[model samples]
Target: SLGQFAISENGGIALAQISNHYLGNFGMIILALIVIIACLKTTVGLMSAFSETFVELFPKKEYRFYLLIVSILPCIFANIGLTKIIELSVPVLMFLYPLALILILLALLSPLFKHSRLVYQITTAFTLLAAIIDGLNALPASLHTITFISVIINFAKDFLPFFSLGMGWILPSVLGFIIGCLCQITITVYKNKKSSTLS
Candidate 1:
């Protein structure tokens, strides 16, 4: 709920403006209080999550150590400023979101494939490759301007369906899944035939 408020604060302000037009000063004060509280709550929750992750990752390190690191790290990022952080994070989020989605979708559909490792491996490999390319495309202009990267980006845009939509992985992942299923079926048949001949 705190996260939702943080994300929707701009829209909440729009609603507050409409209320302020009719309710005058009282509505504005209430909106201001709500916004402040929501921001504080969300920030605390985010920091807690970050610190906990680090603490868990480094089991031998004391919780206080990870907590201190997490607390201090954000100050450095804040000194770098919010806009720059957003600029850097947006590209990474763009790159990661597709792979995340594929994993989630595959997890949900796992039972349909009988939890096949071949299917998982194949789909994940294709998704990873596409995600890496998409991530490279999202790099800062100087990095992206390299000749090899530019050519690869151009080739992907020209040849891959949905590359422009940040969904370049979909077709390839699906193809990989299909191919993997086929391979699994062929292998299973071969195994059965070999066992039958041995018997």
Candidate 2:
């Protein structure tokens, strides 16, 4: 539900056409990725950066109550905002891809995010190219741990459709899990570094 309103009364069709064009097929999407990369922006980079920064200063695993109390409400609130925006006009949400793209950039670039501009630039560039490649390629399905976990989660979610919107909630839940795991690993690595330095 994109919350974008047409500036004029007759602009709804124009907006829909734009959204349709943008979300059309692989060729257009790949071209869009190329354009987005040429401009140096992505969702993964943004999310991972935020996650890293958040974990760095607030790395206390014991403060789950304080952290969840403070964080969960905002996330839920944001989801509500998204739901309302979707209600406004789902088509415009496609153009609102920047936020989601930034999160994707964060997740993809997490392998390189740190306290260095050089690292951020390198990771950002790498993530841009990688994302473009991912967009172009049909990623092979593998029988790996992520695959197994996804399958089991999908199976479980099948019985719990009440929590799902329309389709299974597995996709969004899996994405959230992936981001969470990335943050967890980053924090774990940070903890190990501190331990080594102390040792």
Winning model by TM-score:
1
**TM-score to native of every candidate shown:** 0.76, 0.21
Task: Show model 2 residue runs off by greater than 4 Å.
Answer: 1-14, 19-41, 62-199
Clashes of each: 0, 19
Provide the global lDDT of candidate 1 against the true structure: 0.80
- lDDT score at residue 23, model 2, on the 0-100 scale: 74
- Encode model 2's per-residue lDDT on 1-199: one tens digit a residue: 2345444333434444455566766645666566568644554455446566667777864344444554565566556554354444442333233235645655675565433343344334433433332222212234223665455545534553432232223334344445555666677789999999999
- Candidate 1 lDDT over 1-199, as tens digits, reads 3333333334554566665776789988877887789888887888788778877887888777876887798778878655577668767887788788988988899888788898888888888888878887787888878999999889899988999887887888888888878887888899999999999
